[model samples]
Target: MRASPADIESICLSLPEVELGISWGDRPTYKVPRGAKGRGFLLYRAPGKTAIDPVSGDMFTDLLVIQVADEMTKRTLVQDPQSPFFTIDHFNGYNAVLVQESRLGELERDQLVEIIADAWATKAPPRLVREYFANR
Candidate 1:
């Protein structure tokens, strides 16, 4: 089954030290309480002028911006033909991938959990990361 926005929020909040916040007024954002300026790991994106549907020319409202460990990770996901993850011009030079909510069925629930956990680890402090891994 496809994941919903509520599912995303629940997964994000499941990570250690994750806090919910709003960005751009209402878009949901998840952050780790560590790192410079409190690292944001995930965001619900509303496509701006830079990101639009090629066929319909409409902005994507059900988009997610998920932070990856690095450019390589982002590239791998976006470049894979089977991956639901993609990127737009707005995300150039950024270590993140965009996924459509409606297309989330492309990934299994456990896969989604791993992605979110990896994202949290990228933003989470070493101590927290160590603790998380030790528990697992």
Candidate 2:
């Protein structure tokens, strides 16, 4: 089954202390509280020259940027040729992966949940992360 944008929003908001914030003008961003600051864990990316479809040479209009714990985690997600996760030159050296909203169906709903939850853990306070995992 295909996961929709609504599914993404729902999964992000379900995490502990997550907040919906507007970023890059009007794009939706999910952030987790850390002390006095809220760190973004996931966001809808705006189409630009950075990320484009090689085949069509067109900017991707429906991309989602999801944070990861480290470069290893980012590589693991995007290294698989069949994985919908990917990265562009603009994101090199960044601990995140980009996936088109349209390709979300390539992952199972549970898989989607796991990734989003993982993204949350990456930006969530250490105590919150420990508590969240401890309860689970």
Candidate 3:
């Protein structure tokens, strides 16, 4: 099951200045606008690490599952700049990252919500959310 696009939109709305976007695997993503740090919703994904871009305070994503932890060298699956594409972990690996652009979208709101919802269902933290949801 995939994430619903509307849920993706909801997540985006949860953040400030964040607009809906498509992720690497065509998953829903949020586009942070300039000045979002000042006005965008507060981010709580992962904290406490060497700041890579001090000016932005955004961590440079790497391949070691550090997108939620730390910065490390990473390989992107995205190839064509004209299209949404991205890959991770050598040529073929268990984990991968998708590249989606919030700047553009051909999908509709309802459709987006549905897709995002599905994606969120399988989102990582792996055994975390699933276990929590089950216990709930």
Lowest lDDT block of 10, candidate 2: 27-36
Q: 1 or 3: which has the higher lDDT?
A: 1
Candidate 3 Cα errors over 4 Å, as ranges: 1-85, 89-92, 95-97, 123-136
Order the candidate numbers by lDDT, best to worst: 2, 1, 3
lDDT of 3 at 37: 29
Q: Mind giving the per-residue lDDT tens digits that candidate 3 earns over 1-136?
A: 3332233435445433345444344433343442332221112122225324345776534211112111221132234454333333332443323323331254455543433332333333445436545763
lDDT of model 1, residue 136: 83
Off by over 4 Å in 1: 1-4, 24-26, 34-37
Pairs with backbone N, CA or C atoms under 3 Å apart (clashes), candidate 1:
none
Model 2 stretches with alpha carbons more than 4 Å out: 24-26, 34-36
Task: Estimate TM-scores for all models.
Answer: 0.89, 0.92, 0.27
Candidate with best TM-score: 2
In order, the Cα lDDT scores of the candidates are 0.84, 0.88, 0.34
Query: On a 0 to 1 TM-score scale, where does candidate 3 land against the true structure?
Result: 0.27
Query: By TM-score, highest first, what's the ranking?
Result: 2, 1, 3
